[model samples]
Target: MTTSTQIDTERTDILEMLAKHRHFLRLTVRDLTDEQAGLRTTVSELCLGGLIKHVAAVESNWAGFIVNGPEEAPDFSSMTEEQIAQWGDAFKMLPGETLAGVLAEYEQVAARTDELVRTLPDLSVSQPLPEAPWFEPGGRWTARRTLMHIMTETAQHSGHADIIRESLDGAKSMG
Candidate 1:
């Protein structure tokens, strides 16, 4: 490959890494029934379904910090038990939302990310990172760091999703 081609390949690879882990997480719970997706074990109580939901939520969040602007740090302090339960209610199955439903949302988020990466200049563009509640006051993050964080976060959740899937059934590798 030419130098430019190699760089493009690496860029695609990085983007794929961001999407692939979420894909694996989605697949992990796809075959599980409602009851199965909710099954929990030690070390963590999140079920496959909840993990997937969290993945979708977090993806949109990080995407904002990278592609758009700052993240609106989620507000949970005022949530009632019912609302909190809904956030983590893996098996409860929100109206019109199955595993497939959530995956579709994830895909949209990914599509937006692709557009952002294509249109925006390289991460070295030296723009000031957006402010978020978690960001240290005056903190600045490069576009590269933002993308890397997304990939790392997705990888960790994918592992959790795998374990949750195993507990749900005997499902193994996405391979």
Candidate 2:
């Protein structure tokens, strides 16, 4: 097979996996009202709508990082209390936020990311990791690696959503 064919195949696989996890996450919130989507089912601050919002933001930021490097990212290691609090609040839906709105935004982000995966000149492009206490001092991630991180985050949060859904209404995502 040609190199182009191999790259196309890899892209297809990446998109498929991401879509699958996204489906599970969305499905967990299926039929939930705005209030229910904002409910904290567990001790965790995460809510259904917030999960959607957070995942969308993560994807969007990482996609931008692929093209623009980390210049736009805030320095996590030096964040003030307000910045840290704002980051924590990203896990919950604030007043006036609706499940439908977040869902719509997630769709928009997912669409943009899908197009990015399809049309990126090369998935091997690298970007330095943002300054964060959690990351290695000088780590760099390729576009492909960033996509994998996005997929992992989505899948992990989907599982969290499933547990939250089950706790909220006795609904199980895969059982």
Candidate 3:
């Protein structure tokens, strides 16, 4: 196949995988109440609402990296106790945060990510990795790798959410 055709096919396949994983993740929280969605059913702190929030945040950040390079890194040393506390709860729904609102935000992020995936000039274009303890300094990643990372992140969290969901009410996402 021609280079253009190859890129087109890869793009289509990546988008399909992303959509499928997203659908599976969404299924974990479907028809759940706000309290149920936020329930920490597992020994881990993970909850369905939190997983949704985290995947949305992670995808948005990675997509931003693809379009705009790495964002300013946070200064953990300068953070206050309250700021540190807030960071720990970043994935979870805080008081007054509803499941519906979080789900809507996730949908918005997903739509924006889809548009980015469809319109980026070349998936092979590379960018420097953002500064994070979990990421190696000076590391660079291609747009294609970024999308795959997003897919893997979503799938991993989807599994965690599914387990949490099943624990919450025995509602399995898949058999």
Candidate 4:
């Protein structure tokens, strides 16, 4: 909804759903310092800052896919331990990374995505899935489907962030 163009109800719904989940995910980190944001509270390695970072990165990549189709995907099925570790780093707040920094990145990513949703000429435009073990080969996803994927991913990670926050200090994002 950035321009004079009238968005349909579906686009508005996508934008609203995205905004709602992103709120909860970000709220999970409210009042946390960088150190606390990076602290892993569960057996899982997920941290609050990392969740925000991951969500932003996911949104950015998928938005790029909507625009330009899939880029070269890493060979996850045959990754070296070091490569695997680097991939794992996506779920971490590395040294010198700050909660504020990640949040800023998330905002920029989200704005771009919202604009894409608002301005994309056709939500039915589809992109072929990148070849990967996990993805069904030859599968294609429409822009609308891709946006739903982004929303679902954000919702899933928001739940993770809520758990991390609860474990950190008994804070509940929705309660």
Candidate number with the higher lDDT (1 or 4): 4
The TM-score of predicted model 1 comes to 0.73
Summing lDDT over every window of 10 consecutive residues in candidate 2, give the lowest-scoring window: 70-79
Tens digit per residue, CA lDDT, model 2, 1-175? 3499899999999999999999999999999999999999888888888888888888888888988999756667788999998877778889999898999999999999999999999999999999887889899999999999989999999998999899999988897
Query: What overall lDDT, based on C-alpha atoms, would model 3 receive against the true structure?
Result: 0.88
Q: Which residue pairs overlap in candidate 1's backbone?
A: none
Looking at candidate 1, the ten consecutive residues that score lowest on lDDT are: 124-133
Kindly indicate the candidate among 1 and 2 with the higher lDDT. 2
On TM-score, the leading prediction is: 2
lDDT of 1 by residue, 19-121 (tens): 6776776768666666666557546767666666776677677667665555433456566888887666642345556666666777787787777666665
Local accuracy of candidate 4 as per-residue lDDT tens digits, 56-174: 98899899999889773455777899999987898999999999999999999999999999899989899998778778989999999999999999999999999999999999998
TM per prediction: 0.73, 0.95, 0.91, 0.91
Give the range where candidate 3 is weakest over 10 consecutive residues by summed lDDT.
69-78
lDDT of 3 by residue, 47-154 (tens): 888889989888888888898887633456578999888766867878898999998999999999999989999888989887668879899999999999999999
Model 2 lDDT at residue 83: 90
Identify the runs in model 4 with alpha carbons over 4 angstroms from their true place: 1-7, 72-81
